[model samples]
Each structure stands twice: as structure tokens, then as C-alpha cells.
Target: MNIREYRAFFLDTLSKAYDAAEAESLFYICLEELKGWKKVDLAMNSNAELDRVELVKWNEVLTQLEQERPIQYIFGNAHFYGLEFFVDENTLIPRPETEELVEWIINENKGKKDIKILDIGTGSGCIAITLAKNLPQAKVYAIDVSKDALAKARGNAVRNEADVTFIEKDILVADSLPESFDVIVSNPPYVRNLEKQEIKNNVLQYEPHLALFVDDNDPLLFYRKIAKLGDRSLTGNGKIYFEINQYLGPQTVTMLQEEGYKNVILKKDIYGNDRMVSCDV
Candidate 1:
């Protein structure tokens, strides 16, 4: 089939699942891989064609996208903070809101030197690698419970050329964390079981639930453990950063305050969701 015809087919199939703009976006992303054609190629040559074998491979990709499979997973690559990271079923896809948290950490420690940072639940190593790349003067360590997830994170750190120490451990089962940290940041599983309805089908079907969910009865389970750990782990004037659940921002802030963390602040993502919280000892 020709480029134009294949584009039409791709758009029609994905439009049923996504909005017109999103569908078109996905369509061109497919063309870039299938035909090595840029967006301008579609506009410049509407009648480009493909061989039968090429069409078959393209068909498989479109079939997955039609099934609400994430494009990043299909491509095995995702961009975060202007760098590309490998992604797959083993790791959660990096999101833009998390980029904001990374940016905040970079901004918060722009001129600081020789500090230590720990990233709890560092799925895909997005936060840890970004911090390590930006703050070369700091020691960055990341821990995740899932070996599969840690494998992906370690690969990403190498690809990004960031120096990060990846540890395989479950924070929930641990009694205490290592001390002497100047900053601790985490974007742990905050989505309650009751909040599953709010998640889109693509995520619910394809993303790793271990990195996305928490107990319904105690939604703040991970946060409480991390907060208590931070209280014990951080040095004087050490800061803590969390990407929190929008539904429980106030409670999260209150919990941090009760843990003796001062200057607690809750902030929203670009989408206006209550997404980030910061506090210091």
C-alpha cells in the first residue's frame, strides 16, 4: 500500500480509540517507523506506497495501537526531560508531570554541591537518572521492589549516561532506610484501588499495576512509610518531594506535617491536578 493509503488506514483505525488529533499523531508516528517518513513527508507526498511485507509489519503495529496499547511501549522508547529512555511492559511509561518534578529538583538544587539524593520506588529510573544527570555533584540512589522494573531502570540510566545506584528492595517491608540523605524524592504508587475507574483503559490494561496502585483501605500506605523513613534518613534541612494523589493532597500534607516535616507545600501539575508535595526537615 502507498503512504497515503496506509496513513488513511492508520488514522481511521486509531481515531475510533483516540481523538482526531491524537489519532493523527499516532498515525505519523507509525509512518516514521514504517516508512522512515517525517510528518512533512506525509504532507509533501500523499501518494507514497509500501510493499506487501512492509504493510504486514505496519498492520501488526496498528493492531496493537487499536487495542489501546501505549505507543511508547510499541516503540520501546519514551522521551522525558528532553532525553530518551527505553520503556516496555516491565516499566511504567514516563509521564510529563514527572518531568515537572524532575525540573523542580533541578531548580531546588541548582547551585548546591556534594549532596546525596535517594529516589524511592524509582520505576524506569526517570526521576533518579534525570536528577543524576542534572546534579552531577550529588550522589543519586534509586530503589524498586520489582526486579523487572529495576532492570529497565538500570538500562535507562546507562542510555542516559547518568550515574545512579539502582537497588532492588521493597520499601514496604523494610524497617529503615540508609541515612545521610540531603534529599529524598518519590513518585510512588498513589492511585487507590477505588480510583481505578479514573484511569484510562490503555493504562489499566498494559501498565504495571505494582507501580500504579495502593490499598483502598489505606491509600497513603507507601507515603507514610516513605515519610517516616525520610524523617529518619534525611539530615538537617534535608528536603522531601512527592508526587501525590490529587484526591488526598490535604491529607498527604497533613501527614507530612505530623511527621515533623516543616514547610510542607502542595503543588499542582500543568493539568491543575494536585500532583506534587514538598517539605523539609
Candidate 2:
């Protein structure tokens, strides 16, 4: 069948799972990745026929989408801070809110010299790689507990041509860092089990759970441990940043203050939800 015919079928098949507008968007994204055809190309070549192999690939993607697999996972790539990184079942797809966190860090320390930055739980190394690429003088390091995740993160650092040191260590059990850092940042697992209903099925089903969830009884498990680590590892003027759960913003800020951090500040994302916090050592 031709492009136009297949487009109609794709939208209709996805209608039950996604709204018309979202279905349209997903259809175009799939077409661009699977066949290198954009909207204008589709408009100009509406009658262009799909060969048997191409049709089969499209059908497979359609099946996956119906199964609620993320499109980024299907294509094995996701864009973050203007760079594309490889993603799979091993890593969580990068989100736009996390881009804001990256931007906030870059804005605060754009031209510093010889600064060291550490990203804890750097599942895909999105934060560390972006910092290295944007701040050429800064030394960036990333840590993740999962070897599979770290392997992909290392590959991403090479793909982006951003020099970063990837370490395999679990922060909860570690007593000290390898060295001090001017800045420490994390977007760790903050979603509580009680809030699982708020998460979309595609995320809850397809993304790595170890990277998405925390215990409902102690949701700040990572924050508490990382804060303790920062207390010992931060340079005298070092600052720490976190992308937090909106529901626990005030609690996170209070925890930092109790840990003796100064200038504790909670900031909101574009959606105006309290999503980020920062403080000094």
C-alpha cells in the first residue's frame, strides 16, 4: 500500500490507545525513523508505495506501539539537550524536565575553570555527558549501580564525544566518593509506590523499574544517602542539585537544611510543579 493508505491505517489502529493528535505525532515520528519520511515528504509523495520489507517493519512498529512500548525504545534512541543518545530496556528515556535541570546547572556554572561534577545514578549519562560537552573545562564523572546501564552510558559518552568517567558503584552502600566535586547532581528514582497510579502504562511497563521507583515508606532513600555523600565529597564551595518529586519538595528541602546545607532552594519546572532543588555545602 501507499504512504497515504498506511497513514490512515496507523492512526485508526492507535486510536484506542492514543488521542488523534498524539496518534498523528507518533505516526510521523515512526515514519521519519523507519523510512526517513517527514510530513512534507509524505505530502509530496503520498502515493509512494511501501515495499514488502518496509511494510513489514512498519507493521512491527505498529504492533509494539499497540503494546505500549515507548517509541524511543523501539528506535533505540532519544534526544536530550539537542544530542541523541542510544536507549534500550536498560535505560530510562530522557525527559524534558530533566533538560531543565541540566540547563539550570549549565546556567549557574558556564565558564568556571577546572570544576569537577559528579552525577549519581546516571542511568543514561545524559547529565554528565551534556555537562562535559557544554563545559569543556569541567571534569565530569557518572556513577550507576547497573553494569548494563553503565555500559550504555559509556557508549553514549563516546558517541557524544564528551569525555566522562563512568563508575560502577551503588551510592547507598558506598561510604565515600573517589574524590571531591564542585557540583553534584542527581535525578534518582523518586517515584513512590503509592504514586504508581499516576505513571503512564508505557513508562511503568517499558522503562526500567530500578530507575523509576522507590519504597513508599521511605521515598527519599536515595536523596538521604546522596546528601550524606555530598556532605563529605563536596568542595568547600560546592553545590548539590536534585530533580525531586513534586509531592515531596518541602520535605526534601527540609531534609537538606537539617543536613546543614545552606541556601536551600526549591524550584519548579515549566509545569510549575516543585520539581528541582539545590543547596550549598
Best-matching candidate per lDDT? 2
Q: Assess each prediction's global lDDT (C-alpha) against the native.
A: 0.90, 0.95
Q: Which lDDT tens digits does candidate 1 get at residues 123-227?
A: 889999999999999999999998988999999988999999888888998888865799999999989988888899999999999899988889889988998
The whole-model C-alpha lDDT of candidate 1 against the native structure comes to: 0.90
Q: For model 2, where is the 10-residue window of minimal lDDT?
A: 31-40
Off by over 4 Å in 1: none
Report the Cα lDDT for residue 262, model 2.
98
**Model 2, residue 129: C-alpha shift (Å):** 0.5
**Per-residue lDDT tens digits of candidate 2, residues 174-261?**
9999899999999999999999999999999999999999999999899999999999999999999999999999999999999999
Q: RMSD of model 2, in Å?
A: 0.6
My TM-score estimates for the predictions, one after another, are: 0.97, 0.99
